[model samples]
Target: MSLKSSITGNTKVLCVIGHPIAHSMSPIMHNAVIQDLKLDFVYVAFDILPEHLEKAVEGFKALGIKGINVTIPHKIAIMKLLDEIDPLAEKIGAINTIKNENNHLIGKNTDALGAKVALLNAGFDIMEKNVLIIGAGGAARAIAFSLSKECKKIVILNRTEQKAFSLARDLKKIATIPIEGKKLNEQHLKQYLFHSDLLINTTSVGMAPNTNTILIPKEWLSSHLFVFDVIYNPLETKLIKDAKEIGCKTLGGLDMLVNQGALAFEWWTGEKPNKILMKNKIIEFLNLKQC
Candidate 1:
C-alpha cells in the first residue's frame, strides 16, 4: 500500500523541523520503519523559519504532533519554546529530540548518548581514552560534554580559536577531566592527534557537494586512533577513508544518525523500531555504502 493511502485522520504525526531541511534524511528512515512496523504514525519534514518558530510551536500543540526531531538552527532555539527540558539537554545547551504528551513538549538531547552507543557497539570504550574533537559547534558540544565525564582528557580544535576555548571552559566547569581548546591548524592537529585515542570530526568539512576537503592529513592518523566523522550524507568521508587506509578503525555518521533516530522513536512510541531497516533505508536513499 502507498504511504499516503495508509494514513488516516487518527494517525499520529511525527516530524523534523529545520531551516533548509531539504537535505534531511529523517523522514526517509523514520517513515520506512513506521511502515515496516505498521505503526499508526506518519513522519514528515518541515522547513520552518526562525521567525515563525513560535507560531509553529503553537500549531504543533493544536495539531497534537506526537514527536519532533530538531536539527541545525532550531536545536538551541526550540529549547525555550518547550514545556520542559531534560537536565542533560539543558547542560549541553542543545536538544535534537522532543516528545509531546498532551501538548506538553519535553526536550532531550540524544546525539551524545547515540554517539557513545555507536562507539560501544563498534567495540570501542571511552573510559580513560584521550579524545581529539574537531569543531566547537552544537554537535561537538554535546559529544564533548558527554565524553568529558568518562574520557581521560579532551582537546577541541576549531577555525575560530576562541569558540573552541569557550566550549572547553564550559565543559571544565561540569567535568573534572582535562579539557583544552586550540586553533585548528596543522601544528595543533599533529600535536594532539598523535597521542589521542579517538578523533571525532564534528565539522562540515567533508560534507556532501564539498566532500573533497579533510581536516587532518593521512600521515597524522595512527593505527591506535579510531576516527569518527559526524557527516552521514556521503557515508564514507575523506577522513574515514584515510583512517581506514592507515589500518585504523573508522566510523561514519550513519550509525549515529540511526541510533539517535531510534532513541527518539522509542521515546515517542514506546516501541523499538527496526534499526537495520531504518539504516538500510537511509543508505538506499543516499546510494552509498555504510562505512
Candidate 2:
C-alpha cells in the first residue's frame, strides 16, 4: 500500500483477487509494466476466498481500488457482484477483468481476447481453423466464446458428457461457428484430433511439477497443425515439444498471460505497457522463483 499523494491515490490501485492466489504470476507480470511505464499505479494480489468476494469487491470501491483480474473459483461467481457485465463476459458467463469507475464495478473477460491475441501472435490464423478446446471449465468457456468469432468451428472436450452439453447450450446463442461439446474419450479424441487445425489445452496439464504429463498423445497430432498449451511452468509442454518434433508450431501460456496483463495495465493507466520488457521480466522472474 504505497500511496504517493492524495491526488494520485484514487488513480494508483489495481490487483488480482482470488483464493489460493500464491500460485498467481500477476504481480510479477503487472509490476514490470507499472515500473517500466513509470506510472503511479501498482498491482498487487489479494487472497480472497469465495465467502469474501462480495465484501472484497465492496472494499475495492470503499478504498477506491481501480481494477482487478478475477481467476479460477471466482471468475463465474463474480458476475453477479458486478454493476454491469460486458457482452463477452455475459456470453462466456465469466469475468477475469474488472474496473471500478464512478463507484460502479464493471466486469469484462480478457482471457478470450488474450487467447485470440496469443494465437495470432504465434502466426496461426484462427479465422478458418478448426479449434478443439480441452476442459469445459471457465477457462474453456471463455476461450470457446472468444475464438468462436474467428474459428470456422469450435468443439469443447471435457471428461463429462453432461458438462460438455451444458457448455454447448450456453454458446449456441453467441457464435456463428458450428459449436458442440462432447466427452473426451479415445474415440472422441481421435475424431476430434483428425479434424482439428488447432488443439488447445486449457487444463492444468504440463504445468509445474507435472511437466511430463500431456492431455493428448503425440502420435495423434497433425504435422502441419498448431498445438497450444496454456501451461507455462515447464515453458515447453510435452504437447508443444512433441508438436515441434513433428514440425507443428506451438505456443505456451506465457504470451497470453503477458498480453492480457498488458491490456489490463493499459486499462488501469492510459499508458502502453512495454511488452518485451514485461515478457522478459516474467520469464526471468518465473524461471528463478521457487514453486
Candidate 3:
C-alpha cells in the first residue's frame, strides 16, 4: 500500500495518548492500515502528562478527533473522563480504546477480547483450564475477568498479596469459577505451576531494561504449561524464552497488541483493516531499530 504523502485539514485525526508515548508502535501499525484502506485519517502519538490529561481530552473533543487509544497510566484515569464506558470495560476497571461519538467520548476495552482471540488463534483452549496469571494490574484484571467465563479456575499471583486479593475478590463477584489470589512466592509457584494449564505474565518484570530478569524460576516451568508474556518490546521476554526451552508453548504480547489495536481501528473506521499488514509493520519497525 502506498503512503499518504501529506495530511490535509480534512484528514480526520486518530491518536494514542500516554505519559511516556515514545515507545508505542500504535502510530506505525495504525497509519499503515489507514493508508492501506485509503482512509482520510492520520494517527499520531502524544506524551500527555498526567496533570494535562483532562486538558488533552478536552482539546480532543474541541478538535473533533475521531478516536484515541489510551495506554499505560492513562488507561484507568481516562475512564473517569469519558462520558460512557462499555459494560465489560466498566467491570474490568480499565479502558484502552476511546471513540469520540459526536463529542461524547465512549470508552471500551479491547485488551481482553484481543488476548482471548490471540490465545484461540494460537490453538490454546481456555475452557476447563486452570490459569495462573502473574500480575494484579489492569491487564491481569482484564484477562482474568474475560477468561472467567471459560476457564475452570483463575489464580492471581502478585508480589503484593493484598492487590492480588483485591483483584480476585472484585472478579469473583461476576465470575462463576473459583478464583484465588496469593503472593507470588516459591510455595505458590510449586503449588500452581504443575496444575496450571496456562500461565500469563501481565507484569513488566522481564521487559526491556530488565531483559535478563524472569519472575519465575526456570525449574518451576513445566512442559505442559502454556506461557504468555504481555511484553513485546523485546519480542521474547525471559519468561517466554525459559518457557520455550522447557517445551512449553509460548506467545509474546505483539499479537495481543495488534489485535486490540485492530479492534479499535474497526470500531472507529467501521472497516476491518488488514491485520497482517499491521503486524508486519511493527515487526519491520522493531527489526530496523535493532539493526
Candidate 4:
C-alpha cells in the first residue's frame, strides 16, 4: 500500500501481461517487494488479448517500461515480439520475463530457474533421481529441459500420446539421460509413480474452480514419492493434499511463482528483493481472496 504514496511521473513501470490477468498475484507480490525495498518502480497487471499483443509490446517499448512478465497466452507469442531472446528460453520455446534496455527488449525464461530453486530449497535433490512429470505443456517442457542433465530419467505423460512423444523427442536432443513420453493412463501412471523419486504436475487439472478433479488416483501415490503441483490458487490443491495424506512430501506453486518473479525483479532492478516478504504477501492476498 505504501507504493501508492511514491508513484510519480518519474517512477519506472513494471507489469505482468496475460489474457485473463485478474487472477494473477504477481502485482501484489511484486509491489510488496518494491515498496519494502523502496524501489522507484511500480508493478501492475494488464489483460492484453491475443490480438493486441503486438501493439501492447510496442507500447512497452515506447513508454520505456522497465520490464514485463508474460503469462498464459502470451508467453510464447511474446517471444517473437522481443528484440532478443535468451538462449535457454529459446530452447525451452517460451519466455516469461522481458527487460527493456534502451528501447531494446530482451526476453528470458525464469520459470525453470524458479522451479529448480523451489525444489532445492524444499530439500529435494534432482541428482540421479527418476522424475515423473504429468502434462506436456509449456511448464512441463521448461522443467524437463532444466532438469534433464541431473535427473537419471525423465518421464512425461499426457492425455495426448503424440504430444507427450513430441516433447520427449525434443528433450532427448539435449538430455543425456533416458527421457520417455507415454499416454496418461492407469498403466503408465502406476509404472512411473511406483518408481519415481519425484512427481511434478504441470497441468491445470487441480486448479481453482476445478479443485475437485485430481489427475492421479489416491491409491497410486506412495509415501516415498515427492509431489509438486504447479498450481497455487487454492494454496493446497487436491493433488498436494492427497500427496500429503499419503505421507509424501509436497510443495505448491506459490513458492515457484515468487521465485520466478524475484528473478525477474532482480534482472530488471539489479537489486535482490526480499523473497520471504514477497511470498508472505502472496499468501496474505490469496487468503483474503478465499474470504
Which is the leading candidate under lDDT? 3
Q: Give the per-residue Cα lDDT of candidate 3 at 7.
A: 78
The worst-scoring run of ten residues by lDDT in candidate 3 lies at 1-10
Encode model 1's per-residue lDDT on 1-291: one tens digit a residue. 255556888999999999989999999888888888889999899999999999999989999999999998899988899999999999999999999999899999999888988888988899999999999998998899878888999999999999999999989889998889999999999999888999999999999989999878898888999999999979999999999999999899999999999999999999899999999988887884433
Q: TM-score for model 1?
A: 0.96
Q: What tens-digit string does per-residue lDDT give for candidate 2 at 54-129?
A: 9998998998888899887899998998899998789888889998887999998888888788879889887788
Regions of model 1 farther than 4 Å from truth? 288-291
- What do the candidate models score in CA lDDT, each in turn? 0.91, 0.83, 0.93, 0.92
Runs of candidate 2 exceeding 4 Å displacement: 1-11
Residue 143 lDDT in candidate 1: 90
Look at candidate 4 and give me any clashing residue pairs: none
Q: What is the C-alpha RMSD of each candidate to the true structure, in Å?
A: 1.9, 2.5, 1.4, 1.0
Candidate ranking under lDDT, highest first, comes to 3, 4, 1, 2
Better of 2 and 4 by lDDT: 4
Each prediction's TM-score versus the true structure: 0.96, 0.93, 0.98, 0.98
Q: How well is each residue in 1-291 modelled by candidate 4, as lDDT tens digits?
A: 455576788999999999899999899988888888888889999999999999999999888898999999898888888999999999888999999999999999999999999999999999999999999988998888889989999999999999899999999888889999999999999999989999999999989988999989888999999999999988999999999999999999998998999999999999999999998988888888788
* lDDT (C-alpha) at residue 146 in model 1: 78
Give candidate 3's error at residue 207 in angstroms.
Answer: 0.8
Model 4's C-alpha root-mean-square deviation from the true structure amounts to 1.0
